[model samples]
Target: MADPTPAEVQSYIEAGLPCQSLSVEGDGRHFFATIVSAEFEGLTRIKRHQRVYAALGERMREQIHALSMKTLTPAEHGATQ
Candidate 1:
């Protein structure tokens, strides 16, 4: 299969997980995601990453090779503003 586009990856995550806001950028094999959601509240960094990985499911191993993410709750995302 051809590598997935950033949009495809973004849509996949959005479909599987609940997000308040999300943006993804990448060059097929590697991706960077800035994800904001209520689901991230009170979770540790590792847990937050795990949640994203869970959202990706088998594609994380089978298709996507590398993913770097910034996961945050809405409040956290707001604080940066």
Candidate 2:
């Protein structure tokens, strides 16, 4: 009945991707997350995003309606402006 704040989403994502930088936006129902993690190094973009979704667990289906994610490796993030 209440919107999950951006900080809340950021916290969840951070827990999933330690040592990473994250930017998350959510309307409590839909969320957009941008994450940079070294853990994503060898993983495909789909797999990397799946990992973040997994971190959200049932919330993804039950509470969260949609998640638009952009996951990048640390190096990739650093390369970007």
Candidate 3:
């Protein structure tokens, strides 16, 4: 079977985060995900990312080779955009 694509991972995470925008890229092995979520508010970077990783569950350790993430709260994203 083929490995899950970055978009697939992104969709999974997005489903879990909800009310967020996500950008994802991968070489079918390593992946980078930028997730913006209201749920990230007041959370530290590590905690925000941990939430994303938790959404991935065991796939993060088993199928996913690498995941680099940038998590931002809605306000934080709005300021930059």
Candidate 4:
């Protein structure tokens, strides 16, 4: 299978998770994402990543090679901006 594009990965996440804001940047094998969502509000960092992984599902293992992400709640994201 071909590696997913950043747009494809972004769509995959959006399909499964509700996001206030999300952006992904990557080459074929590696990706970095900044994801903002209400669902991450009370979750730990690890759990937040887990939520994104769950959204990716089998695609995470079969297509994408690596993903490094910044996961944040809407409030947290707002604070950073």
Summing lDDT over every window of 10 consecutive residues in candidate 3, give the lowest-scoring window. Answer: 11-20
lDDT at position 41, candidate 2: 94
Cand. 4 Cα-lDDT: 0.95
Q: TM-score each candidate.
A: 0.97, 0.87, 0.91, 0.97
lDDT of each: 0.95, 0.81, 0.85, 0.95
Q: Which stretches of candidate 2 lie over 4 Å from their true place?
A: none
- Tell me, by lDDT, which candidate is best: 4
How does candidate 3 fare on TM-score? 0.91
Q: Model 4 over residues 1-81: C-alpha lDDT tens digits?
A: 888999999999999999999999999789999999999988999999999999999998899999999999999988998
Which parts of model 3 are misplaced by more than 4 Å? none
- C-alpha lDDT of residue 81 in model 3: 96
lDDT of 4 at 79: 91
Question: Whole-model lDDT for model 2 versus the true structure?
Answer: 0.81
Q: Tens digit of lDDT per residue, candidate 3, span 1-81?
A: 478898888887977787468999999879998888889888999998889888889888788888998888888889899
* lDDT per residue (tens digit) for residues 1-81 in model 2: 565777887887777667468898878777888888888999998899888988888777766777898999989999996
Clashing pairs in 3: none
